[model samples]
Target: MNISKEIVENVSGIDIVEYIIENDNGIAIGIINFGATITKIITPDRYGNLENMVVGFDNKSKYLKNFLHFGSVIGRVAGRVYKGKLTIDDVAYNLDLNLNDTHIHGGENGFHSRVWDTEEIYEEDKVGVKLRYISLDGEEGFPGTVETKVVYSLNNENELEFEVEATTDKTTVVNITNHSYFNLSGNFKENILNHYLKINADRFLPIYKNGDISGKINTVENTVFDFRKGKLIGEDIDKKLEQLTFADGYDHPLLFDDKIGKIELWESNSGRHMEITTNNEAVIFYSGNCFMKKTPFSKKDKNRRIALCLETQNLPIGENEVFKENSILRKNEVYKRTTKYKFSVI
Candidate 1:
């Protein structure tokens, strides 16, 4: 495996660098540096048809002009912080409010909006590209200058392995992940209402305004949040629930039980099945309802549920003791998590 880097000029005058990784099956994935984003990931369909499974912009200007985080690595703090503020050691700090009344994705200037140092590592067995960046103290109203690295690897097993690591100077909160909107079926025309989904979570954290959990972990018996037994994704998306009106459908985090193993997803259209395995305690199943409705850059029509994000991460703002326990990483402690998504044909 010989990895190569090429400089391609986008319309926005930003010189974008593309890193190509080739797998044994002749499949390849292209990543860009403009936003530390996944430019393209080409895979085969049921009939050996190749298509791009991830949603993204066509060029660098679309990424700049549009608001789609696309397939970029998000960081500092991946999800929302209550009211654009967080308290550390009895001290409160204010962050930039990008999402209306709250701070989303590490405020207006997160790691996705920056350029990182990249290196392409090649090997006969596997190939990957590593993106590294450092955040200064108080950059997004968070403590410590954090050094972070994200490695994107594609192997012979058809698994996309995302390895994320970070270390902080002072004790600052960190939750990094790839904000890639996935339409695994490769058919964006219709909603993914027939897609069968299963999660190991018996409980979920209900999100509310002012950064508070609505209640304790609830059972998934008849509740709309139930996905434990593999149900159609859009089965109950339109129910008149209280949280649905506040954050839209399925915007909360799913709490995985300790006894559960790998999570599975089956796409009826493409016959593509995906399995996710991680060492973390929880996985956030974001339905992408806020894609273009709340923000700007999504290429989707407001009414169409075009994409879904299975973001495997530690709970949002791990500093919140009630929301996620044992999430705080102290000084001299290393924070590491690996999320692997394997593709298979049904």
Candidate 2:
């Protein structure tokens, strides 16, 4: 079915487009134009009652006014950049340091702040929405005029797949990921402490003294970073770590020991389960410890440790030599990444 295109007023004058996708199993996905955000994902439970599976503000103005990124597509880079500065092709660029003197999420006016042109593609067997945005030169202090496209598809097998592709005229770093907070139980759970979490990474990138990548992967054994054995998130969060002091949670990139196939993570609670898989080697597991409780943007209480974000992306800059290889997209070269989330009841 074709997505019905309609304009929804967000800000005073800013309008957002809503793309609706309906599946045979009564699952519906509502996507918005501002930042290409996934506003609502409605799926039926075992009792055939539908509920929103993701957490987000009801109004778009709240999204603009709130400090939380919230279900938006983050980019030109997702993680932190040291001192809000970077040298691309011998040219030094300074960006808006939004957090702790470091450039986070491509700076203050990154792709998440821009409106994108969208196209809804429908086939007999599959349905998807493609959103495209072009970032002009020097936009948010970035060098290149970058063209980015993200396609969100819902397959018959109950998979939410996101595909990201970008091209730039100038040399720049690009890391994009969807910031969706999932609660498999579909109950607006106060915390995910009981959710059995598993990460395939054996090591992680360590932060240096200056809040940048330390250029090394530390072992996960006997440390708070260890999720290799599938443990609860709260079991080791408050255990005192230097990196957590800044972000207040697990904002570090997990370095997977395996280089092939998919990196997988599973969460189970109350007979409901969720599984995430990605082609990327790293996944940033954030426990949302920085979010404010009972904020205006949060329809329900969104206090610290409420929702968790599993951002699959490259390591923060300078952390791994592998990023230099994995993220190097030369002129006319194409880079591709795919991440999928599937939900079920066990």
Candidate 3:
């Protein structure tokens, strides 16, 4: 394994450094201290051609204004909070409504926009970076001074792992996940419509018209949401079902079946495949349904379904009492989770 670091840019007198870790097999991943964001993931295709498999910007300005949340660590809470209202230990707090009336992705000043303190990790079989961020009390209207640490490591086995842990000084709610837009075709050569996806989920959380969780969980049986057998993403994406139309595409939290194991994604054209394993109960599958007309990275015209995200995390604490209760992080209690993405050629 090999690792290198360089200063990408300086923002407000703080140096934004990028760390690139490569395995012996030639798979390399680049991450920056800014947002602890992943800038690139280059892997080999069937014919031994190396190409980027994730969506990212090339310059610092685009990353500084990364509204898409591409390749960033999403936190405090991963998904939308209903009406921006969160209550913990009988104390109600109103969070910033950055997305319509809902507080999404920890508000506008959330973890994705923060610069983290970083340290390098050199292991016998892996090379990695450990990033730390301290979210002050009342930042983005969320209580508690949260000290978050995220370690990203790449090993020779073609596995990229994320180890996340956080602690808060006050009672609060927290759900964290990585928002990495993946395209197995490599470098966005084509949209992900042809990708085959299998999610080991028997149920999914529905969303309202405004994209907030509807506080209901429905079985995937006989619905377009069913991916138990694996199918092309474009097969039923445009169906006129209420769930499909509500979010323009797939953007729901899939409840993982306890007996089932990992989620799988594959692209035959490039012969690339990925397996995702997480300790979290839910994974949000977001088809890139909201790409802008002129994105800073894309060379061609706007295309919505260019990539997809498998955001593994605890279910969002919407209006669901059970989920909210489970998402709570009491004072001095630690919140820890791990997710791994293993890549290979099919």
TM accuracy, model 2: 0.89
Q: Write the per-residue lDDT of candidate 1 for residues 126-163, one digit (tens) a residue.
A: 88998889889989787788888888888898888888
What TM-scores do the predictions have?
A: 0.89, 0.89, 0.97
Model 1: weakest 10-residue lDDT segment is: 318-327
Q: All candidates: CA RMSD in angstroms?
A: 3.0, 2.9, 1.4
Quantify all predictions' global Cα lDDT against the true fold: 0.72, 0.72, 0.89
Which candidate number maximizes lDDT? 3
Deviation of model 3 at 111, angstroms = 0.3
The alpha-carbon lDDT assigned to residue 159 of candidate 3 equals 99
TM-score-based ranking:
3, 1, 2
Residue-wise lDDT of candidate 2 within 1-346, one digit each (tens)? 3355567665666677777776677667778877888877776666665777677776656666434667788888887776767766666778788878777877777877778888888877768899999988888787777889999888677777889999988777778888777655564654766566888788887776555775777888877887877787778777677776766667778877676324333344345556777877788777777676545334445465666788888776663233544554556766678888775656
| lDDT value, candidate 2, whole model | 0.72
